[model samples]
Target: MASPVTRRESRHFSFISLPIEIRDLIYANVWAPKLQLHVFFKNGRLVTAACLGAQTGDESTGTRVPSGEEMTLADNRPRGWASRDLVILRLHSTWGNHYRCEEDWNPMPGHISTERNACISLLLVNKTIYAESIRFLSQHLEITITDTDTALYLNDDAKPVIHDSPPPMIPRQLLRSIRSLNVTLFGSVDLFIALALARDYNATTPLEVVNQEFQQKVRATMDSNQERAVGLLPKARQWHQIWPGIAALPHLVRVNLWMNHSSFDSWSNINERAILEPLQRATWSPEVELVVYLPNIASDNIVPGEQFNNNDEDGLNFRVVRRVRCPDRVAEDSRVLFIVHDMSAREQEEMGDQGLSWDLGEMSIEMDRI
Candidate 1:
C-alpha cells in the first residue's frame, strides 16, 4: 500500500532513522568500556573533559571537552539510566607544585598528543542522537575527585577557604549523575600541612613569611606530639564534611578511596579505624559499595600473590584485612571493604614520585572477595 515517494524515502533512511534499540547497540559499541569524566576548575570556571583513559592528556581535542550548555542538558536529562556497576574514580591530571601555593598553580603543559581518543563526537551528530548517547554515557560515567581539598568542597553546605580563595566545588546535578568516584585520602600530616600552607600564603605577603610558617609547622610536628594532634584535627573535620556529600549521591554505585602511600606511616599512626570512622558512620544504601585501598602497614611480612580469607585476621598474607559493616544495616547487608596492598619502602618512594595514588590495575590481580 506504500506510495513510490514513501518507498524512496525509506530507501534513503540514515543511521538515526533506525530503531532506537539498534542505534543504542551501535552507540554502546562506540562507547564500550566507558569514558572518564574529568571535572575540575580551570581559571575559576568548572570544566569537564571526557576521555577514554585514566587521565586526560593536554593534547586532547576540544571534542573531548563538552560545552557548558551540553553539560547543562546532560544534567537535566531524566534519571532512568542509573548504573549498578563498579565505577572507578581516578584523577585526570597531576596536582602541580602544591608547595608553591601560587594562584595559577596548575598550568597546562604544552600540547603533546597522547593519542587518547573519545567518542564524544557522536553526541554532536544530532539532537536525538545527543540525547540517547549522553544518557548512555551517564549510565557508566566515572568522575574523579582530584584531591581532598576538592572533596571537602563537594557539599553545597561546605564553604571552606583554601589557598586564600574558596575552593571549587562539584555541581550538585553533575554529582547526582556520577556512577563512579575516585578520591585520594591524604595522610593527616600532609593534608594538614597543605591546608596550612595554602591558607597562610598570600601574594601580598613576602615569600619569606610563607617559608617561615611552613618551616615552623614542620618543626612543631617533629618536636611536639601536641602540635601533631592539633594538625590532624583538620583532617578529621574535612572527612566529616566529605562523607555527607558522598552519602547524598543518589546514583553512585562504587567509590574507590585511595590512601596515599607516602603518608603510610602517618596513617598507621592515626589508626585505620579513626581515619575511616566518618565514612563508616554515614548511612549508605545497600546498592552502594565502597573500597578503601591502603598500604599494608602491619608488621607481618606479606608476600604478593598470596590469597588469604577475609575472616583470617591472624594471617600475614591477607589482601583484604577488614570488612566492617556499615551502621544501621542488617547482618546480611553490604559492608565497607578495605584492601591493603603490601608495598616495599622503595616501591612506595617510586609510587610517590609517579603520582599521589596508585592504580587499581596493579592490585586487581591479587584481589580476592569474601
Candidate 2:
C-alpha cells in the first residue's frame, strides 16, 4: 500500500528542478514534428500538418494517438511516432495574434484527428513547462510554406485578403520566434519576386544596366538566335520582382529557395552577374543567408558513383553526383551555392556579398572526392 502511495506522490514533484538542457531535450522530443510542418489558413482557421497529403485527407479516417499512447505501438507494429510529434493547429493567445476560434475547432469536432488536437495537455500540466517548451519548439522546427496565398492571406467575406500591406503569410507575433524558413519557387514566381524587390530596389540590377555597349552585346548574342532574345525581357522582368522579397524577411536568419530548372537554364554570365551583383551591393541586418538550389545540370561527363561537398571559404557548398547513366550522354548534377549572412548594412558596404562564386559546375580541384 505504501509503494502505490509513493508512486503517486512522485508524479507531483517539481519538473523545474531538472537542468534546463535536459528539460529542453525533453521538450524537443515531445513537441517537434519529425517532418516539416506545413502551416496555412483554411476556412479562416489556421491548419497545420506534418504530411502534405494530410491537408486534403478526410479527418475522420486519420490516425489519432491518445495523450498517453503518443509514443506507443499499435497492432504489433510501431506507429513511426518514435521521432515525430503531432502538429497541433489550434489558435491561441499565447502568441498574441488573438485569432478567433472557429466553431469547428473550439470543441475539437469528433472527426478531427488527435494529431490536430491542441495538445495543451502539457501546457496545462504546469506553467513552467509551457514557458520552456514554447520557446524551444518555435525555434527548432523547420517550417515550409507550400502555398503562399494561404499563408499570407486571411479569409474575409469569402475572399482572401492580404494579412498586411505588401503581405506576409507569417504572423508578426511569430516572426521573431522563427529562425529557419523554406519556400519553393516551383510554379509561380510572384511571391518570391515581391520578396526580392522588397530587399533591394535602389541597387543597380543587370536588367536595368543596359548601356549602348551592353545593348550591342545583347543584340549580337540574340542575332544568332532571335527567339532567345524575345524571351529574355519578360523573364528578366519577372526575376527582378522576386529577389527583393527574398531579402526582406524581417527576422529570418536562413532561407532556402528551390528554383525550377527551366527558369534559370538560360541565365548567361551577364544575367547571373545582374542577379548577384545587386546582392553584393545591398546591406542586410543581423545578416540573413540564402541558399539557392538550382535544378541539376544534365551531363554524362560527370564521374559516376561519386558524391561530395566543397569546403569553399566563401560559403557552404554541396555537390551530389549520381551512379546510373541514361542512354543519352545526359545526367543531372544537383549542386547548391550559399550566400552568407551580411553582418550589417554598413559592413557589407565595404566587403561586398562575401560569398559570390561563379563555379556552378564540378570544380577541378585535385583532392580526395567523396
Candidate 3:
C-alpha cells in the first residue's frame, strides 16, 4: 500500500508530464469563472448582464453609497478596518446579520461584492471538487488573500495547529504547484492597496484628514488589543508585505494582480523581489507577466465571468514574457458551479433548466436544493 504523501503526489502526476499548452488549456477552462452556477444582480435587482458592471449605481451618489463597482457591503465589513483581513467577508452569519434593505440585497452591485447572496457567491461544494478547483486554478494565480484585522487567524477558538509537513492550505499548494501564475487582488482592500501603490487611491482634503485620524485609531487598536497576532502589522504595511512570494516562485512566468493603473508600481522589480525574497528556493527562471486592472468605480462591477479586454496596444506592460487577458477566472469556477454531479432529468430541470444532458463519466453542474 502506498503512503499518503506518495498517493497524493501521484494524484496529479499524470498532468505533471503533459504538454504545456494542454496543461494551460485545462487550467484556464477548468479554472475559468463559472458564471452559470453563480448568480448576479442588476440595478438593485437580481438580473443578469453581459458585463459585470452592467447595472452599477450612480457615480454622483459615489463610492460611499451602494454602486455597481461595490465590494464588501458597508454593513458587513468593519469600517476603518485593516487592509489584509478577509475574515469579515467569509463569515456568512455576519452578512446575514447586516446588509439589510431588500435593495441592498440586489444581485448585481458588480466587481465582486461580499454581501450575502450578492455578486460574490461561494457555494460549499464537496471537498474533492473544492480540492480539484484549487489544484487546477493554482497553476495560473498566486491567490493571496488579505484582511484588515490585526489577528492573522480571526477565530481564537480554532487555533492554527502547524503539523510537520502537513497538507498546505489549498491556495498555497496551488500557487506552489503551478508553473505560471495570474495573481489577483479582488475585494476592496486589494483595491485600496492598488490605489495607494499607484498613487491614485485618493480622497478629498477633509476626507484625507479623517482617514488619517481613522488610521491612527486603527493603529491604537492593534497596539492595545491585537499586539500578539502573528504576521500582522498596520493595514498599509501589510499590503506592501503580500507581494514578494509571487515574484520568487520559480514556475511563475506570468502574473496578473487584477488591478489597473491604481496598482502598477514604478519600482515593480523591487516590489516583485520583495515578495520573492522569503519564498526563494533553487529553481528555474519564470519571467512573470503582471496584469493590473484599473479602478472600476461603478457599483455593478461584479460580473462573474467579467473579462478584462486586452485590445489596447498599450493596455499591458510589455516587459514580461507573456500577458494575455484571461479574464478574472481564478477563484470563480468554484464559486459559481459549486457542486456539479452528472444529473438525472429531474435534477436537470430543478436547476432552472440548465439542460445538462450528462452521461456517466461526463461533466455537469449542480446546486443544492434550497
Candidate 4:
C-alpha cells in the first residue's frame, strides 16, 4: 500500500520573481568582460574590432614569408611595407635577415584572446536579460582609438557575425548612448599633422581622385605578376575632427586621455605644451571632466599618488591619482594616472589600484570585473 504514494516534483522558481536590482547585479557579474573596442583605419575602411573583428595580419594568421632559400640578403623589401602591415614587426627567421639586432617577439597586436560572445550570450538569454545586458554594455564601453583611418560608423556594413545573428555590431544608436570615453592617443606631432593634412586635402579633393591615387600606389607596391588584393579607399580623416561628435554625445560625463609614449624618435623633440595647448583651450560643459594620463614620466617632475597643485583658480584642476609601472615590461611602458579635481578624494580611493574605471547613467562606479 505504501508503494502507492507518488513522488511529488519540486517546483522551479522564475528568475524574474527576484527583485529587479538583484537580477541586474547578477547579470552584470555574469556578463562582465573588459569590453574594449579597438578602432583602426586600414586601407580606407574604419574597422572596429567590437563590430567587424580585428583585421588579421600575415604573422597573426600564420602566413609565412617566402622560404629563406628563395630570398637573398641583398633583396630589397618594399618601402613602408611594414608600416602598411604590422605583422612583419617580428623576425620570423634569422636566415638572410640583414638586421642582426636582438629581437624580442611581441605578441601580435590587437586582442588575441577575448570573451567576445559574453554580451551576445546574455542578450539571447531572454528578452528582459537582453535589454539589461545591452544597457550595461552601452554604458561601460571603452573605445580605444589607435588609428585615424577613415570616418568610423556602426552600421549594417560594419556588423560582424555573432551566434548566427546577421548584424552583430553594436547599433549606432547604442554608441550614441555611451556616457564615458577612454582613449589612448599616441603622442606624435608628425602623425597628427599628416592626419590633419589628409583631412584638409580631402575637403577640396574629389573622392574618386583619392581612390584612384590610392589604388595606383597599392598596385605599384605589388609585383606585376602577383594577384592584386582588394584595396581600401584612401582615408582622409583626423581623430580631432571626430572629437566634436564625441563631445556632443548627450550622456558624455568624462573623458580619459592616455598619452602613450611618443612614436617619434625622441620625447625631447616634442613641444609638449604647444602640442597639448589646443586641447586645453577646447571647451566642454561644466558637467564633464577631463583626466590626462602621462605614462612613464619621471617621478622627480611629478609625485605619484598625489594631486599636483598649482593652487590657482581658472586653471584645469589636475591630480595625480596613481602610478603603475608594469614590472615585466620596459620602464617606458608604465602608466601615470591623472584625474580632474571634479573626482573627489573618496572616488580616487575607491578606484585605488584598479584599472580604468567608469560609471555611466544609473550604474555605480563599482562595476563587476571579468
Candidate 5:
C-alpha cells in the first residue's frame, strides 16, 4: 500500500519539479482522448482499457509476444491495470527521465511500439511502468510539441512514410486511442485543405480508398471508448466545410486550422463578408472560442479599411475592417469580435472610408458559447 508520506513527497517533488501551470498542462494533455495510451487514471486510480487502438482487427497477434518487433503486437493488445502501472513507474515525475524520455522510445527501430509493449509487458512482467505512466498520464494531461519536426517525434530507421504504411502497420488506431490530440502538418494551403478534408470526410477520404474503407471501424471505436480525439490539417474552401461538423463534436475542444490568406484578398479586391455570410447563415455554434494568428504578414495594409464605424454610442465594440466583415446574423456569443488592424487609429481615420465593401479575404471568426 502507498503510504501518505510517500504520496505527499511524490506530489511535492513533482509539484516543484515543474511550473504549476506546466505540470497542469502536461496532466491535462495526457488525459485528453487523442494520446493513444491504452491505459489511464479513473477515479484517482488506474484502470484497464479495452483494445480501442486495434484498427487492423488483429488481436491474435496482440496475444503473442514477438521476439524483437514486439511493438506491433503489444500496441494492439487489450490494455489493463498492468499497463497503467508500467507507465507510472517509467514516467514518474523525474526531470531527467522526462527529458530523456527513454520510456518513450526503444533501442530498436520499432521501439515506440515496444515502448507501448514495455509499458504493458512491464505490467505483465512486474508492475512498475504501468503505475508510472498512469500517474504521468493523470499528471500531464496536456503536452505541447515544442519540437519543430514532429508532434510525437520518435525517429527510427524503419519509420517509413506514415501515409504509405498500412493501417495495420502504423499506429492509426493510436490516434483514436489517444486521450489528447497532438499533430503537425507540413506544406501550403493545399496541404491544409487536404488535412481538413481528411478529418471531415474521413469516412470517405477522397484521396485514398483505405481511409474511406476504415471509416466505420474508426467511428465504432470512438463511440465505444468515448475518450479519444483526432487531430489533422486540411486547407481550402472545399475543406472549410469540415469545421461545422467538427463543431458538433462534443468530444472535440482543441483544433488548429492553420491557413494562408487566399488570392482573393491580395488579387486586387477584398470580399471578407461574402465568405463569412454563408457560414453565419448555415451553422456556427456559440460554444466555441477561436484565435486568429497573423503569420507571414509584414504590414496590416493587407487587412483593408473599415467599412462600418463600431465606435458609435452602442458601446458594442466593433471594427469594420477591410474586406472582412462580421456575419449579418451573429449568434449572441459572436457579438464580441476583434478586428486585427495593425494601422494606427490616426492613419485609419485619414483613409476617409470611401467606397469600402465588406468583401475581403477569408474572415476567420471564433465563436464563444456562453
Candidate 6:
C-alpha cells in the first residue's frame, strides 16, 4: 500500500491574471488619489518633482501657510492652501534630505498620512505591468508650472540660462504624454506695484515721484486693483514664453490657467486680448479643453446684473460659463472649448467639508467666438 500523498495549496495570487478592470481598481487604490507634480529646471535638466506642503485646508494636520520669504524658496512650497493627495517624489531636495535617495517616490512621512504605501514597484514587476502603470499615471498626472525659469526652460526657442555642458531639453516623450497642466500667471506680489506705476505714470512726471505717489495711495486705500494687477500686466510679456511650449505639447487634454487676481472686471480690453488671443491660436487638437479659474472677488464685482446670475437654488456659490466656437467661425480656428470657472468654487470643492466659507457671487465674461 502506498502512503497517501499530501498536496500543498498555493497561496500566491497572480495580479496580472486578474481582469484589467479589477487590476485598474487595485492600481487606483495603491496609487495616490491625485499626484501633484511641480515642473522646473534642475542642473539644466527639466525635472518634475512632488510639491512640498500640507494639502490645502487640511486643518487636521495644523500646517500653516509659508511666510512671504519662505515662499520664494526653490523647493516650490505652496503659498496659500495646498492641493490634496499629493505624492512626494524622492528627487526633491527636501525628500532627499530626510530619506535615502535610493528609495522610490513615496508620500512624505510627516506630511499627509496614508493607509497604504504607493505600489510604484509594480512597474518593475514585468513589462505588461509597466505599460499598464504608465498608462494609468498618464491619465491621472497633473503638472504645475509656477516659476519663470521653468516657463523659459519649456520654450524651445529661449536661450539656455545655464551654461552647462549638456544643452537644455525637456524629454520630448514626457511632454507628449502629459494630459493636464496647471500654470500660475501671478509671478510675484511686487508685480502689482510695477503695473500700477506703469498705468499711472505720465511722461512729464519723474518715475521716482510717480512711484512714491502710487505707494502712498496703496498705503492709504489698500485698493483691490493693486492686488488684481498681479494677474494682468505679466500676460503679454510672459505668456508668449510659456505658450509656445504649451502649444507644442501634442497630447494635452486640459490646460488650467490660474489667474490669482481679485476681480475679472478690472481687466482692460487690451489685457483680456493679451491673454485670450494666444489661447485662440494654440496648435493643440480641437478636443483640448481650456479652463481659466478667475480670482475670488466680492459679489458686487462679480454679479453686475440679473442676466449674469446662474439662479442656482444652492445659492450661487460657483458660476461656470462655457465658450464655444460659433458655427460660422469653424474655419477660422480649431474647435477649442473654453470653461471659465470661479476659483472660490474650485477651492471649496477641493477642500470638501473643510473649505473656506465664501460669500455668494456671480461673474460673466463676453468674448468673440474662436
Winning model by lDDT: 1
Query: Best TM-score goes to which candidate?
Result: 1
> Clashes in candidate 3: how many?
43
lDDT by residue (1-370, candidate 2, tens digit) is: 4555577788887679889998888876776553345555566555554423211112211123223323331232334332111111211111111111221233333334335424434655676776665566557755655444432322111344547534332333343355676543332123223222223333255544533333444456442233344334444344444344435545557765443211212211112223334334434444676665432222332222221123331533212222111100111112221212212335334333433332423322311231
lDDT of each: 0.45, 0.37, 0.31, 0.39, 0.29, 0.43
Q: What tens-digit string does per-residue lDDT give for candidate 1 at 46-164?
A: 55544333211221121212222111122334222211111110111132111111112322233232322246566667888777765666676677655555565556564434575
Candidate 3: tens digits of C-alpha lDDT, residues 181-233 = 33233232233322233221222335455455545554553422222221122
Please identify model 5 stretches exceeding 4 Å from their true place: 1-186, 189-238, 260-284, 296-300, 305-370
Worst 10 contiguous positions by lDDT, candidate 3: 328-337
* Ordering by TM-score: 1, 4, 6, 2, 3, 5
Q: Across residues 1-370, which tens digit of lDDT does each residue of candidate 6 receive?
A: 9765545423344677799999988888766643556665666576555544212211111122223211212344534332211211211122212222112234344544332223445666788887887787678767677655565555556353556546423333444477887765542233434443344333356646755565565555454355444333343234444565776776678886654332222222113222444455556566667765433232443433312223432432222332210100000001111112232444335534543332212111111110
lDDT of 3 at 192: 36
Model 5: worst 10 consecutive residues (lDDT sum): 325-334
- What is the alpha-carbon lDDT of model 6 when measured against the actual structure? 0.43
Clashing pairs in 1: 89-182
Q: How close is candidate 4 to the true structure, as a TM-score?
A: 0.46
